[model samples]
Target: MWVEVLGWIIVIVLFAVGMAGTIYPILPGAVAIYAAFFVYGFMISFSPFGWVFWTLQTLIVALLFIADHAVNAWGVKRFGGSKASIVGSTIGLIIGPFVIPAFGLIIGPFAGAVLGELYARSSLEQSLKVGFGSLVGLFTSVVAKIVLQLLMIVLFIIWLLV
Candidate 1:
């Protein structure tokens, strides 16, 4: 009984963190939730988490990765940004957090997109539009991840209970 209680606690905490990771990239997001479900299944009985569960979870994870990049690139392109803008946005996303704390995440992508567009010889106004598009993509990605993450958690819980 005690072990089961502890397991529940662990699962809940991980789920919370995992969901948080949707927007706060450092947390773990989909992977964390997937891991949590696995751990819980192991602790209880892997029999409940059969191939179907695995397949669905795996697919969702794959989609998460694909959507993350695709959406971002789409945002850039939608705003008339070039390949450079996409590349720059990616670079900024990687380096922004290290250079600036709270705001770096937002600034990095925007600046990167703008700089990338500028490099491509786009006008300043166009560059700004690309930067804004990058931000839209970021937010959209976050929302999508959050929904998918939630779906994963709910699926696990349903399976566990059923």
Candidate 2:
């Protein structure tokens, strides 16, 4: 009993941490949520809906992670950014974790696109356009992930309540 209770607490904490990870580049938010669900389901012995559900959830999370990165790159490319801008965006994303809280998340991607464009072609106007495109793509990706998280939460709640 105590172990189950402990599991619940740990899972909740991990879920929050994972969500935060989604914002920061270093952590995997969806994975955290999936892990929490996985653990809780195991503790309760909720039958087939338990582990199988979470395994599928984990797969979706993984797909979203990949899709997000790809879309962001595509967005930059759509605006004529070269390989340099893409590389810069990646660097900016990595650097974002260390700087100003949530702001870094936005700035990092934008800076990366701009820097990438500047390096690739030395054109300020084109760089700005690429940055803007990248920003839009990033925003869309965030929305999609958030929606996915919400769906997972809803499914968990429904299963638990029903």
Candidate 3:
């Protein structure tokens, strides 16, 4: 009984942290969530949700990981940004949080995209447009991640209850 209780506690904590990680770039949010779920299911011997369900959830996590990058790149390309701009945006994402805390995440990509466009000989207006596009893409990605994460949680709940 004590071991089971401890497991639940750990799972809950991991789920909470994992959800938070989805928003922050530094943490592996999806992976954490998946881990928590995996642990719980393993503890129960996958009684409620079997291998098929587990596999589905795993695929969702994998897709989320890929989608993050694909969507970001799609946004850059959709906004008329060149390869250089995409590279710059990626760099900014990595450097932003460390440089300026919360706001850095938002500003870093925009600035990076603009600089990249400029480097590619784009006019100031065009560079700004690309930057704006990158920002929009980032926002879209966040929304998608949040929704997907919620879905994952809801699925877990349903499986547990059923």
Q: Which candidate is the best by lDDT?
A: 1
lDDT of 2 at 13: 86
Q: Residue-wise lDDT of candidate 2 within 1-162, one digit each (tens)?
A: 987898889777877776666566577777777777768867755564766666767778878778778878888888888888888877777786577576988898898889888888667988999888878877877777777776776777776776
Clashing pairs in 2: 18-29, 84-116, 85-116, 88-112, 89-112
Candidate 2: Cα lDDT at 151: 73
Q: Give me the displacement of residue 84 in model 2, in angstroms.
A: 1.9
Per-candidate clashes come to 0, 5, 0
Give the range of the ten consecutive residues with the poorest summed lDDT in model 2: 44-53
Worst 10 residues of 1 by lDDT: 37-46
What is the C-alpha local distance difference test score of candidate 2?
Answer: 0.77
lDDT of 1 by residue, 1-162 (tens): 877787888889889999888867767788888888877876666888888999999999999989988998999999999999999998987788779988978999999999999999999999999999999998889889989999998899798789
- Give per-model TM-scores: 0.93, 0.84, 0.92
lDDT at position 82, candidate 2: 88
Point out where model 2 deviates above 4 Å.
46-55
In model 3, state the lDDT of residue 45: 44
Which candidate has the highest TM-score of all?
A: 1
Ranking 1 against 3 by lDDT, winner: 1
